[model samples]
Target: MDTNQAGPAAEEALARQEQETITQAIAKELGISVKQVRTTVGLLDEGNTIPFIARYRKEMTGELDENVLRDIEERLSYLRNLGDRKKDVLRSIEEQGKLTQELQEQILKAVKLQEVEDLYRPFRQKRKTRASVAKEKGLEPLADWVMEQRRQGQPLEEAAKYIDAEKGVESAELALQGAMDIIAENIADDPTIRSWVRQYTASQGILVSEAKDAEQESVYENYYNYREPVHKMPPHRILAINRGERENVLKVGIEVTADKIHAFILRKLVKGPSPVKELLEAVTEDAYKRLIAPSVEREVRGEMTEKGETQAISIFSGNLRSLLLQPPVKGRNVLGVDPAYRTGCKLAVVDDTGKLLEVAVTYPTPPNNKKREAAAKFKELIAKYGIQLIVIGNGTGSRETEQFTAEVIAEIGDPGLAYLIVNEAGASVYSASKLAQEEFPDLDVAERSAASIARRVQDPLAELVKIDPKAIGVGQYQHDVSQKHLEESLKGVVESAVNHVGVDVNTASASLLSYVAGVNATIAKNIVKFREENGKFTTRKQLQKVPRLGAKSYEQCIGFLRIPGGDNTLDRTPIHPESYPVVDRLFRELGLDVASLGSKEVAEQLQAQDAAELAVKLDVGVPTLRDILESLQRPGRDPREELPLPIFRTDVLKIEDLVPGMEMQGTVRNVIDFGAFVDIGIKNDGLVHISQLSGSYVKHPMDVVSVGDNVTVWVLGVDLKKGRVSLTMRPPSGNDGGAK
Candidate 1:
């Protein structure tokens, strides 16, 4: 064959091979057939979104789930990049006129991106370096001698005589040493060796430590004496070690056993023996010291840090999701107080819908001489607004503020009124944000914080969605992750929560509406604009008139929007607009109108009548229609209420008040790999270690409990100096009632 025709045929064969390899990798990762993976890749290459593929192309993909589809999308990007780099490498080697059958075959058969890059590195043009300088001289022949030690089986001194002394090869020993240096640099630059070392360190390396010279006593005493495998270390310990290294209290190093790694590398690059065996051994020793050791150490640390960061981000995402879905205490007028001692307390009152009614200051705590006057003003505001609840910010004087509210309610004697201590973790952060400034431009930062406290009590989900998820303070190691990854993961959590709860179309703010599954800022603003231009939506069909809303967007989001007084009964229910025809057919089959099937009892009566008969009449499946019927039975029900109501305490206790044998109620504040931290109204939270979680052995804290769980714990021990509280879920003495 001529060169041109042969070249095209060879290229076609190589491309086919690359495609087959990628298809196999994708099929293995997704647990699907190779044919299915090929079809999915073809669709993805044509610019289809994951949601679209998973929803519309079930037959082609064999019903791949969303997670599997996302994986395929990511793998496709990587494979395309590999192909682009391979073409560039072939062109560059051809330009240099060094292309050969053996080299081209090796490149084509390479499985990993790193292996391809390694084969192409020597052909790549670059700036001056130690190896380049040595090669520029007549020392290339000497370097080749060092590389051939295993094949030639020659002594190092005999190989050194071939180099010319005029080109800086002064003596036999000097030439051998210089040649060793060149070979060491080559092995260090090998991408395959670096990749292997990275994997090895990630799996088996340990982070060991010794104390620093300056600091004698530090918080990292345990880490200073500890040696943990890099992959097995928990996030908390990793963060602690990083913090210790930053403070110069410890000298950290990654310790890897050299024998295992050295043997592995030698097996790859060195065969039996030849004339140049002595020179190759010297080169290998030089490579270990000059190139491999430093590179491997750096790669190991980087991998450890990245792994810790990923695990921390996963934990933060879970906690933030739970904190956002906390149940709302809706439709009750609230009074919020930002308590203080040196400064007067800032108080704000909002009506049942969170409209600011009044704002004032009070001096009800220490250093205030007019406690009675403050008490009188509080009572007057409560009676005027008919306040049903009091929200106190859990800050400096939170307990004292709770006591003040309790005393006032007792004197007035209203049994229906109650007070709650709200978590104020991000109240200050929100108070200073641009959103807060726009909402309350004239109010002081303190007053805005007080307003947030009141709004949080009325609707925790809606108001909390306005603030950043990270600032809510439920995570254990949030600051250690990539900020972009953390933000995106937490946004997913908020989106899930908002869609699951079903927002109120008439009352939701733009911020809350933006979190709906398919809605962005522009769409949320359009919803609000439509609400303002035309009054409340009487029917969901009106949403179609809003700009930028299409069929797909409406299909995903309409079911989560609740209209209170719509034209049809299903408008108030979670049934999507597309599903409304099926529901109408259902009502027609029962000989009833939408108005007659309003209550759960009536809906159940209709459902008890034969779904298969209704499905035949309606031309729909029994499964979908049954789901629509259930949704119609309870329109706009809050799912958060199905969980336990949040626990609010009237008093705060100190660590000294707890005894070893006493049991107390506590709320879970954070969960880590080793244990859970519980807030039992004490200055120091108690730890429920993993071993004490249950009778059976547990591997992770998440296996037993999660954040916001309420449990009764028995105090096992308290170390006053260390400020550590140990707690157990096991019952004390003979009072066994199963684990809580």
Candidate 2:
């Protein structure tokens, strides 16, 4: 097995060579000058933001788009991690002082992380083992003699005869056995064998299953009858299988056919004479029993974990995007209803600012014969409160409640009062949580749920941020990922959303405050506490008095905190508190008060004029001054509101109702590697495969559509028995414009 041949210096040289080759490859693919690539790489190594670099250093990058810049950033991270691992391996090997010429050459020639680690394994620190004990007893010479016999076609017994008893070599048979054990251990530790096994398993293994020994019923029935190739298994299926395994409803195994691997390894390691052949066979058998099986299992598990994490991250990103984009139902008194069957529906009425004004209960669903009375009660509540919007929880009996609300609205004949089905995925989780109990001790759990639905309608971002991201149910496989990574990533998404759409400081909840950039839980609480003690913040400077809110935190967070009626006119704008002086300079240059600039009509007038003239007069960059002038012109504007509203249909069709060439209005539910799934009022979301996503060829589904986006789709095919609906984004006949 040539165990003593590969080492660290060789590996370092190989990695450096590979890195240069990859860099050249990337430069060629990106169609950029080599110098530009190098400069971008260097800047990326220094930890610069892509947006900052793209916007501010266009001369250096030659105006690289965000996609190319992000690609470079991700690739650079991988290469840097690889380089760090190489260095660690080299240091560990050098400390062992096993710097042989042959070993150095082999290590330097290795190309992958797995190969480098394999070469370093023999010298790597390990726990107490049989081989280490044999080496400690001074049996290395005898072991080496036996190994030589395997090469020379000598009998094992003859090779074992020269062993001395006192040094732990008691008999010829025992000596030969000890030597064979060492040989097996060394062969098993060989990097080549482990690498080969990993490749074979990844390419060919299947996750197969059988029923558990005990009878059990589970939600994951599909996995019990399923088998999928490891490389092709979808993320959701993997999560389902894992969840089933955790529940002990199935016994899962990663199946790798053994004969093929055995033959491959035998051909690689057993090419010498008869004794050597026998020893190689023994080692191969031992490798499978002692090393190969366990290693293959670990590798499969790790692959599954990686796949699961990627899927989970995708799901989280999609959910966060949807939550952030949820439409803000503004300027209306909203009545939220959490409907139930056994228990009556819990209702809460909140005004435009989302302060709870009333709470009640009613039976409006099945198992209740008082339907007419329930209708009367709903009309009385809406008329009494002058409610303009009805937010209903899309939980149990949601459709029936929707029908009930529609009937009541029909009788009132008021088209102004419309109903929206608010997603209540995490509302239940929040209602049962400690925070909910703390905030509304007098309210029952059902009432809390109603309040959440109402608050979401008032401002989706603010209320959705209160619940854990994973609990927000827009994901496909959230439970399969690392919880800590998922939490951090989703938190970033929430913070980005909150910062993107500036929050009203006086009206923001502590939960919403926590998502502001640079504001931790403690600072958020302190801000709320200060608000309670000192009334509304009259000026931005008053924030400094809040405990633990230092200058740095204030600088990062103040721009996003909107004070509706502050002393300084710029305090209500998105301009940072530190940038107040810049706004003052602009005001002085324009011969205008800050209040005069805070009107949309005035902002449009400023934008129509020459921005460069304003910049030169104010002594700032044209871009910076233009941005400031725009912000001042339309104070407290929400960026999200500029995007189009989500379209809902007056009528919905089921999967069974879908016919070929039928047009339907649907919202894209998920965009994946292969396709986009649209929820066209069907239990099973219809698939618009990548081939059908656009008229032009696209390498990825994201090129056309993203989650939460609404589009018109044609029903291309339907298999009702199979519960599958195939859809296409292409318009039917000669209609170039889409249907909605």
Q: Write the per-residue lDDT of candidate 2 for residues 540-598, one digit (tens) a residue.
A: 88988999998767766777788887787778877766557777787676667665765
lDDT score for candidate 1 against the true structure: 0.76
* Residue-by-residue lDDT tens digits, candidate 1, 480-517: 66788788767767776777777888888889988875
- lDDT (Cα, 0-100) at 263 in candidate 1: 71
Off by over 4 Å in 2: 1-120, 124-130, 133-139, 146-153, 162-174, 204-229, 244-275, 584-593, 598-601, 608-626, 647-662, 668-703, 714-728, 734-740
TM-score to true structure, per model: 0.85, 0.80
Model 1: residues with Cα > 4 Å off, grouped in runs: 1-27, 30-127, 150-174, 190-192, 214-217, 273-275, 365-373, 403-413, 550-552, 606-623, 719-724, 733-740
The global Cα lDDT (0 to 1) of model 2 is: 0.74
Instruction: Kindly give the stretch of ten consecutive residues in candidate 2 with the minimal lDDT sum.
Output: 644-653
